[model samples]
Target: MPEIRNFCIIAHIDHGKSTLADRLLERTGAITEREMQEQILDDMDLERERGITIKSHAIKMDYERPNGEKVIFNLIDTPGHVDFAYEVSRALKACEGALLVVDAAQGVEAQTISTLYQAIDQDLEIVPVINKIDLPGADIEGVSQQIVDLIGCDHKDILQVSGKTGDGVDLLLEAVYELIPGPGREKDKPLKALIFDSIFNTYRGSIVYVRVMEGTLHKGEGIRFMATDKEYDAEEIGYLKLEKMKTDKLEAGEVGYVIGSVKSLQDARVGDTLTTTKNPAKEPIPGYQEVKPMVFSGIYPTDSDDFEDLRSALEKLQLNDASLSYQPETSKALGFGFRAGFLGLLHMEIVQERLDREFDIDIITTVPNVEYEVHKMEKSEVVKKIVDNPSEMPDPGKVEQVYEPYIKASIITPSEYIGPIMNLCQERRGNYINQLHMQSNRVEITYELPMAEVVFDFYDRLKSSTRGYASLDYEFLEYRKGDLVRLDILLNGDPVDALSSITHRDKAYDLGRKLCGKLKELIPQQQFEVAIQAAIGSRVIARDTIRAMRKDVTAKCYGGDISRKRKLLEKQKEGKKRMKNVGSVEVPQEAFLAVLSMDDD
Candidate 1:
């Protein structure tokens, strides 16, 4: 029997995880020259289209050694975003070791630091790979040291490889064989498997991913998912060995897939234990942590008529991803949409793009939001506050609370922009930390800032302010008390809670003016004049308006090709359908997306 190995590649965003996977695929001759596409592991259309690794892909490669030894490699690629940390964790559980990829120029980043700790927590051996060595800003030596410092390994221990040029790629494969330990499952024991991942297929029903610990499985066998206590006959037992092709069976100390006519999602929990009736394992795999989506927002159809379609789309997505949560709620402002929770903003974007592109639905998102704790004198309450403008906050009474989540932010940039960057961070209530010099001209600065500060348009501001030379990464820390108040935007006298927002006093004016400016553009010239008021409580801080359209109808509308005139009126009605009316004034979807565009103006 061939010695089997399973490993996963992990990294921070843009650290070249997918590229490394591509080089490995190429090195093993698994992909032909024509099939030699970039970032082949990024299989999802959105993942490839956006050039972001939102989903993970895996493949098996057959390796031959000069010493006449043969081995099978199961390489799994995983998402780097903290939002998908749970998915990463599940992948990690199936592996005995990991290829921890880091951008040579960027050193360690937010999710890198976060996921590294998770790998360590899982007791998996680490094999650090410094990628992007072919790039202009490569800091191979300095980043090597950072790896040594953070991971407590020597500089010689870090492997420097460029997935782009395939430099040192052969050595990366060598390390996989030399450094990573082989699977630890003992054959005599009963069957114990951890279902790391799963997906639903139209023809196959549901397919589950599992790492076998003991015993073996075969076709027509019976098995049980521990969580659901549901048993299903193994219609097929397979290995993703060469392709997603099937095998007669997969032995213990291997990773493979199980497919049957399954339906319930509960049968395929990420951390669930799987066992067979022939023999039962005494204990399940040790490490398990349920992943929860932290950020939420309303998902609605741009056309209110497609509300049912939106519901079905969300349901279809939820069927595959059990972590996605939803609560049916009515938006007093936007009619009805599901309040959906996601792992993070990127997760929110992936869902939105899939809805807009895959399902061909026009979704109106009410802003990516977070859950908040409303503290009162008597008791504390948790609430999902979708405050876009602060004017709707009730008068302070029976309460004493001001808290917002903060994050530790790490920014890598050219040293030339450090001064302005530092000033901007200070203005946003960022607490300073030390900086490290990388290469000859690059620096990595660390800071702790409220998540709210960066949650808005700070990304754009940072890019524009730094002349696009900076990269930033952050993860949630703890909530802290600050001088915070709700900022509200009013369309006429009625407060639109969708426009109500909580912000630090220092940033309220800028955010308010910026938000109001967006509303001004989104609000077309109404039949009647409409005031766009941004305020704190009743105090209006910024004001703009959509002056009523005067003489909207030209004599041309009545006379031209009368049929063409009718077509123009129909077009006007369709345009009006795209606009969301808040009370009497019409606001377009661009208005919500443009909420942060005022900074450019």
Candidate 2:
């Protein structure tokens, strides 16, 4: 245990966390030249294609020091996006130390500060590292000072390295071995292990990734999950390398995987305690907080027959991503579906894409919204209800007050772009908190913004307005009273439950008008005119019409008398009115997607 070092890499997005990880893996001889690749820890094709890390990856490395001492380093590379902050928190809990990598050019951004605070809360030893020093714009001295102010570490204690060129990585490794202490726990104690992560395997049942906090786990041992109280035989036990390396036993402070007869991820949840059935620990590990999803949207199978298949797919996915929460729901427009909750909009998009590519399920997703607290009068007594879907909200007349979720958002950007960023925030109805000027010309601005306003295209707009120089990190603050209302979209005079959204009263009229215009463009023209109306209760706020495909009944009587043509036109008008009454408009999938991007401009 003295030679074992377990640590994770935490950083802001695109700050060279994965690149730095690759250099360390190469330096430690974990992967050979033939297998070398960029962002090697990001194995998912979606992650590579998007140049981002989604899931946290754990790997073991064997490094030999100059003094002939061998060290075992368990490195977990985590995603840098704010949407995956839960992943970072889980990774931090399993390690004894962390490498807080900051970009030399970008310095410390919003996510950097947010993740650093998480690591600090975990009481992990933080080693500051400045990455991408090879860039011509690299501000090593300025960033080093920023690190000093942020972490309170000495200026010389910070390590400077270029992840792209593999410079100064060897020294960084030395810091990990010397500065970061090894896991300190007794092996003789009763068995106690923390399941940090788990994944579902088709043939193997469930593969659980565990960090042994106490005692030892051997191959073929009878194990049990304390939370679930389910027992299974440990069929296989091994250390996590580039691949699973089978081992006879795992000692205290070791990180590895265990294959068992557990049927699904639900049986072996992440953050659950694992112990031997015979000598179970007296108590489970503390500090396990259930993930609360921030954004809610309905996911329906494009084909109704695939409903059961979609459920099974979501179960498998939940095993891997515990942050995803869902429950069965039925919609009049979309039919049977699950209203799924996600960490953010990107997380929702990724889940949808994974369902399509990995599970081959065609799904329709509704407009995303945040959970709202509705205080309504029931029989002269006020009752509070949590409503995620706008359709689930009670009648406006009975509701006394509605509170929307708010977030404390922190944005870090260069001083030059602060005006545009602030204006953008103000346009979203943000309440200014405070601002602080950090080292160099960079500034950190804080604001209290409603989560509903940030859910749609806020991140994309922020990036474009700042020219990709700004980084944003936010957390749920509290629910605040807001003059909110449910905006309903009507297709041919029928309210589509799937198209209803809870929005602030101030923005409802403008949003309704925009939604109606967008739907008019995407909804195909029918034989009869299609009226797209946005409404609140019985009052229509905005309306648009898609002209019907005309048949020109008068064309056949071109040379007829004026009265004959008028008679033909009147008959055609009656036919159109009758068709409009019976015709049910089929809203294409594109129109549902258009609702999500209505505020892009």
Candidate 3:
């Protein structure tokens, strides 16, 4: 049997993971010159534009060794955002080894360290590739030292290659073939294949990506999900010779696609196992970890009629990514907003971007939200309330405690920006972890902070302080009891209905006051003056005044410009039509975004 090698490229955001995959595909002749697309591994338009791999994409290529031996290589690429780290982990589990791409200029980033530790835990052989060697500021030696100090890897084995220039890429390939051993096959073992990632195909149904570990899987083979025990006859079992190109069968130790009698996407659950009943492997593949969404928000359309379309779009997205959990929810005030669950804030943003850009839906997104715990003093119990609004927290005084998620963060920036970052962290109630210095004049500072504290504005604040030179990454550390309260904002002296949420008391004070001030700015002067008050229950926090409009007269029309007078009336009607009437006040999209804007406060 021919030897098969399966590996994944893991890197921090913008660390050249996809770029290296591009050159590897080119050198392997898996893609013809004309077939090449920049970052082909990033299949989605959003992925291409964002310059991040949002989904786990795979491509097969052929490489000829120095001894003229042709080998088949299957490579998987994954997103670098912490939100989709679960997706990345699934991709890593499917591979026997990995290519750890670290930017020579950036050195060891938080994500780099995080993913490297995951790779180590998987016990997969890692080939550290210091990419972007062609860049002017690239420091191969310095980054190699980081690999040693942080990842505990040997400095000599670290391969320095430019994924862009294709310099020294061949050495990295050799290391893959030699050090990363070919996947082993147990011929006598039962059929056990892991579904690392899968997608819906119009013609073929749910095409489960199967990497055969034991026995061979043929076309029309009967397989069942080991976890769900849902069995189906495999209609078309094939290996990826190249994307969309399929062969007849996937032999043991090879990665391929299984597109047969799949009727629904629910059948092809990622991280599930597919095995033959007669000869199933004693144990399923052992590397998969469940990916739970970490961030959430509602997605609603402008036109009430488009509600169904929005729901359908979400369904299709969930068909491919089961990790994205959402349930249909309706509000008399807001109409409809999906209680969307995400792996992280970035994941939430990416989903919204895909919905707006790809689905072509005009959506009004609520603020990115985190899960909150609501305590009931009467019952002496706490209810986890991920979706918080004024209606749910009606009995605010009865609550004793609320727990929110917290994260361990690591920030990398210039030395000059350290003080500002430290101050910012301290202001957010951060417990300092440690700081390390690198040879290229960058510092790695660590902290433990409430996830809510770092949810928004922190990135912007960090960038503002550092002049856009800082990069931050964090992972959920744990959830703890916090001195939190629900801040509710009332516009026009009445609660703005939907603008109520929970936060730490200290955070709520500043955030509530700031939002009330912004709401005043957002609420245009109506026929009568409006009062914007931010509060927690009956206790008023901050107040802002929006005085009634001053002047409302039009310029006198000239004799020749009667048409101009008619045009003015038409413009007024159109503006009125666009403005939303809440009671007697008018609100626009800007008003909605203003309350939710990152820096509106």
Candidate 4:
């Protein structure tokens, strides 16, 4: 316990957190030069494809000091995105300290500050390291001052290292041991361990990653999960190295894994406490909260027959990703589907991509939406309803008011682009909050923006406006009263339920016009002219016309028979009237997906 040290790495996305982990593994001789891989801790194929860490990984490394003393290092790599903040919280609880990695050229970004505050709140010792110093644009002096000014850490103590070149990495390992203390000792106490993370394997069942706080856990011991109170025999106990290395037992103040023959992933939950069945701990560990999904969208298979297969694929995927939540829903236009909730936009995209690539399933995802509160008045009583889908909104006459979710968004960038960012936020219905100057040149702007405004292409536009120098982070604030109305799209004369959306009253006309124009371009022309209109309640805000495909019936006629051509045209017009009464527009799948790309103008 005296020589064992546990710590995690936290950083903003693309700040080289994964690269630093690889360098640390190399320095400790955990993997030889031959076994080295880029982003070694990011295990998912999707993660590698997207070049981001979506999940947390823990590995044990053995390091030796200059005094010929051996020390055990338990390294946990956490996700840098705000969507996985819950996972970061769990990882921080299992470790004594964290390494806050910052890019030398970029200084501190949005996620950097957000994660740093989380670590500070957790009371974890933070070691600030400036990475990517080998780049020509790397500004070591500027970044060091930023750390001192923003985080209030000593500037002289900050470690300057290049994760790419492996420069100054050996000193970082030494600093970890000197700065981070070992786990507290309680060998005589009853069995107590905190489950920080878990995974499901087809052959071995559930492999739970745990940090032993007290007592010992041995192989073949019956243990109970504090959250579920379900007992399972620990089939194997071991340390989490590059692979699971079997051990006879794990003692107090060590981080490792337990392979219990748990049948389901829910049984081995993260943030749950584990204790021996014979002598259970008096209470469960603190700070265990169930994750609630922040965004909701409908997912439907391209082929309705694959609904069952989609359900099965979702079941298997959820076994590993417990944060994903879904329930069966049917759309009139899309047929059978499921309304799934996710943590953020990236999370929603990742899940959709995995379902497509891994499961070999073609899916059509509707436009993402947030949960809204609808207040309806019936006589003298008021009924509050939570609506996740816009099509499910009550009639305009019955609804008294509507409230939409808002977020406290933080944007960190160079001071030059502050004006454009402010204009963009205001256009998206963002209310001004406050701004602060960090380290002189960098600025942090706060705004209260509706969640609906930030969901689609907001980040992309911000990057474009700032020349990719700005980063945004947001948290859900309470719902507020909104003067919003439901915008419905009508094809010919009938409304399309899937194309309905909730928008602010002021922007309703412009958004409706855009959506109607987009649909007109996407929907193929039918035998009869199609009238595409965007409506709000009983009024039409925008309209577009798709001309019917014309056929020159008198083109083959000859011999200067002008009167004969006119008679043929008359017959053709009469036939077209009959076809127009019975024809229906055949909208392609692209029409449904086009709504996803609609942005705030």
Candidate 5:
């Protein structure tokens, strides 16, 4: 147990976390020269294609010190994006220490500070490491001072390493062996392992990734999940290296994978406790909080006959991604579907793409929105209801008040970009808080803004305006009362529930106008004019028209009397009116996607 060092790497996005992990693996001889690659832990093709890590990956490493002391290291690599903060939190729970990596040239940024606070809250030992020292603009001294101020550690304790060149990684590994404490061993106690993550395997059922806290788990033993109370025989037990290395048993203070006959992920939930059926633990592990999704959208099959297939695909996907939440729903225009909730827009996009590529299912996603709390008067009683879909909102006459979620956002950037960043925030209805000047020429500013405002394109705009120099991190603050209304979009004369949204009253008119204009350009022209209208209740606030396609019906009457031309034109107008009444507009998929990028106009 003393020789077992369990730790994870945490940092902001693109701060060499994965590269550092590769260097550490190479230094420890975990992977050979033939298997070396960039972002070796990010095995997903989507992750490598986008140059980002969306999931947390764990692997085991073995190393021997210069003094002939052998040690076992369990390393977990985590994502740095704010959307995956929950993943970082889950990874922290299974480790005793963390390697907080900061970019030497970029200094300390917003996500760095955000993840640092999470690590501190977990009471994990913090080891500061400055990465990317090989860069020409590397400022080791400036970044070291920033780390000292952030973690309050001595100057000599900070290690400088370049993940690209593998410099100082050996020393960093030594520090991990010396600084990070080992997990507590209780071999004699009852079996109690915490399931940090799990994935569904078609051949082996559910493969559970766990950190054993007490006793030993042997192959072919009867195990039970404490939360679900479901018992299954452990088919195989092994350590998680580059691949699953089979072992007869897993001891306490070790992290590994357990293959059981558990058929569903719900039976092996993340944060659930695992124990032997004969001698179970007295209580389950603590500090497991349920994840609350911040964004909501409806997902439907392109062909209504594939509804059942879509449900099964989502269920399989959810087995791998525990953060996704969904329930059955129906829309007037989109037909039967599920209302899905996600961590953020990026999370939603990844799930959508996975459903298409992995499951081979065609899907249509509605406009994304946030959950709202609606307090309405029902038979002289004030009842509060949670409404994620705009069409589910109660009538205006029965409403008392509506509350929207807000967030506390922190941004870190160079001093020169402060003005532009502040102006951008102000445009999003942000309330200024306070600012702090750091050691370098960087500033950290805080703001209180509605989560709805930041959900759509805020991060993209921030990156473009600051030329990718700004970093942002935000957390849910509270739900506050606001003058909010449901904005409905009508095509021809019928409302399209899939395009409806709930927004603040002040921005509704402008947003509606922009949406109508975008839809006008995206929606194709029909045989009759298609009237696109945005309305709040019965009052139409914005409108746009797509003219009908004419076939030159009066061309034969050009050499005839004026009355004949008039008669032919009248006949054409009447035919259009009849077509407009019976013909339903076929809204192209692009129209639904246009609502997502309305801010670009």
Candidate 6:
């Protein structure tokens, strides 16, 4: 264990974390110069195209010191986005130290502060490294000072490096071995390993990535999940060098994958403890919390026959992303679908895009929402129930109070756009908390806001208001009592279940009116006139009509008698009245999605 080191890399999005990983890999000879690629740690095409890491990965590398001593380094690369906080936490738990990379040009953004707190909470040894020194206007001294002010680190200990040019990376690796202590060696103890992450395969059911905490784990051994108590036979064990490399045994303080005869992904849950069946550990490790979904929406297939295919795709997606949660749902207007939950807006968008591009399925999504706590009067007493769907919300008279989720949002931007940014946040019902004057004439403002408001295009609007000069990060706060109302959209007096939403009562009328007008434009004109109305309970606040198609009966008459034209017009009017009584309005898929495209605050 003295020669082995476990560490992870954490940074803000697009702050040279992946580039640094590639440079370190090249410097250590993990991959030769011919095999190197930009952002090699990001394996997904979506991640590569966007230049961000969405998942955490573990790799084993062999590095030699100047004294010709060999050291084994287990490096885990983590996601920098706020949506993947759970992923970041899992990676942090497996490491003894972290490399906190900061961009020299853009010093101490919102996510950098957020990730710093997480690493501090884990009590891991943090080594600050200022990256991207080759860029124009790179301020190494300014960033180093910011690190000292924010994290209370000594300015002299901060290292400066350029990830693009592979400068000072060798010195950074040597500092890692000298500064961070290796894991303690253990023996004569029961086998205990922590499953930090896992993925599914068709031939081999579940491949669980683990970090051994106590004893040895070998191939062809019987193991049991400490949480679920389910048993499995380990089929293979190996290292994760961006690929599965087979090995016979994995000892304490080593990170590797364990292929077992497990049927489903749920059987091998992330954060669960794994132990050998014959000699199990005395107790499971602490800090195994389940991930709760922050955003919820309905996903319906465009073709009703493809509902089964959508379900299969969701199940497969859940196998890889354990944070995703879903259940079957039926909508009156959308037919059969599922109500899916995600970590945040980005997580939700990525899942939707993958379903379309990877699975070849076309789907329509409702406006995103967060869970609400509804308190209703039951038997002369108040009863509370958590409601995620607006259609499931209770009537206003039956409830005593309604609580909506809120988040503490942090924004870092140049001082020039502070006025417009504050105005935008206030328009969305944000409550100002405090502000701090940062270096480089920048400001960091904190606000308390409704999660619903931010879930639908809040980030986009913020960027537009600030001209893309601002960065934002947020964390979930507690639920607070809110004046909430469920707004329902009705087509020809029939309520559409999929178009219902929960909003603040003060802004409900304006939002309802806007939705009614948008739906009027999206729904095609029909033979019979269709009335679109937005209602709150029994009160209709807004209404619009799609005019019926008009026919030129007189044109077809040519030089015929006037009486013939009158007779044709009367017959047509009678036919329209009959059709209006029996026909139903067909709302297009775009009509349901149009609610999400609205930019009005």
User: Candidate 6 on 188-257: residue-level lDDT in tens?
Assistant: 5788888888888888898999989889988999999988899998889999886689999888888999
TM-score of each: 0.82, 0.94, 0.89, 0.95, 0.95, 0.95
Please give the TM-score that candidate 4 achieves against the real structure: 0.95
lDDT of each: 0.75, 0.90, 0.76, 0.90, 0.90, 0.90
Winner on TM-score between 2 and 3 is 2
Model 6 TM: 0.95
> Which scores better on TM-score, 1 or 3?
3
Q: State the lDDT of candidate 4 residue by residue for 1-601, as single tens digits.
A: 3389999998999989989999999989898888888998898887887778998999999999878889999998888898888888889998889998999988899998898888889888899899999999999999999999977888878999999999999899999999987888787788889998888988888889999989998899999999988999999999999978999888888889998888887888889999999888998889887888888899999999999999999999898998899999987788999999999998998999999988999999888888899999888789999998889888888899999999999999999999999999999999999999988499999999999888877889999999999999998889999998899988888888888888899999988888888998899887778999998888999999999888999988887869999999999888888887888777789999888887655
Local lDDT at 386 for model 4 = 94
Candidate 5, residues 1-601, lDDT tens digits: the string is: 3379999988888888999999999988999999998899997888888878887889999999999888999997778888988778878888999999999988898988998899999899999999999999999999999999888999999999999998999899999999999998888899989888888888888899999989999999999999889999999999999989999999999999999878888788878889999888999888666778999999999899999999999988887887899999998888999999999988998999999988899998887889999999999999999998999888777889999999999999888999988998998889999999988888999999989888878899999999999989999999999889999999987999999999888989999999999999999889899999999888999999999999887766648588888888898899999999999998888788788777644
The residue-by-residue lDDT of candidate 1 on 1-601, one tens digit each, is: 8887889987877788887888888777777888777777776787876767775666788787668699888897788876677788788888888988989877776567767888898788899989998989887888887788778888888898988888999888888998888997577677888888887886787788888877777777888877667888888877764357788776787888888788856567788888886666667776655666667677767788988988998888877777788877665567777778887777877888888887899877765655554454544553333322232234446336666778888887878999988988997789998898765466788999877676556777888898876777776788777777777778876667665667777778888888887788777786556788888766888998777554444456655577786776676665554543533665566776565344634
Q: Count the backbone clashes (under 3 Å) in each candidate.
A: 15, 0, 6, 0, 0, 0
Clashing pairs in 5: none
lDDT tens per residue, model 3, 355-419? 98778989887666677666666556655554433346645687766677888898988788899
Writing each residue's lDDT as its tens digit, candidate 2 over 1-601 gives 3489999987877888888889999999999999998889998889888878898889999999989889999997778889888767777888999998999988898988998999999899999999999999998999999999999999989998999999999999999998998996688998888888787778898899888999999899999998889999999999999989999988899999999978877788777889998888999987666678999999999999999999999988887777888999999999999999998988998999999999999998898889999999999999999999999888778889999999999999999999999999998889999999998888999999999999978999999999998989999899999999989999888999988999888889998999999899888889999889999878899999999999878778858579999998898899999988888999888888878767645
User: Which of candidates 2 and 4 is the stronger one according to TM-score?
Assistant: 4
Cα displacement (Å) at residue 93, model 6: 1.3
Q: Candidate 4: lDDT of 161?
A: 95
With candidate 3 superimposed using the best TM-score fit, by how many Å does residue 410's alpha carbon deviate from the native? 2.2
Which segments of model 2 are wrong by more than 4 Å?
303-312, 558-561
- Residue-level error in angstroms, candidate 2, position 317: 2.6
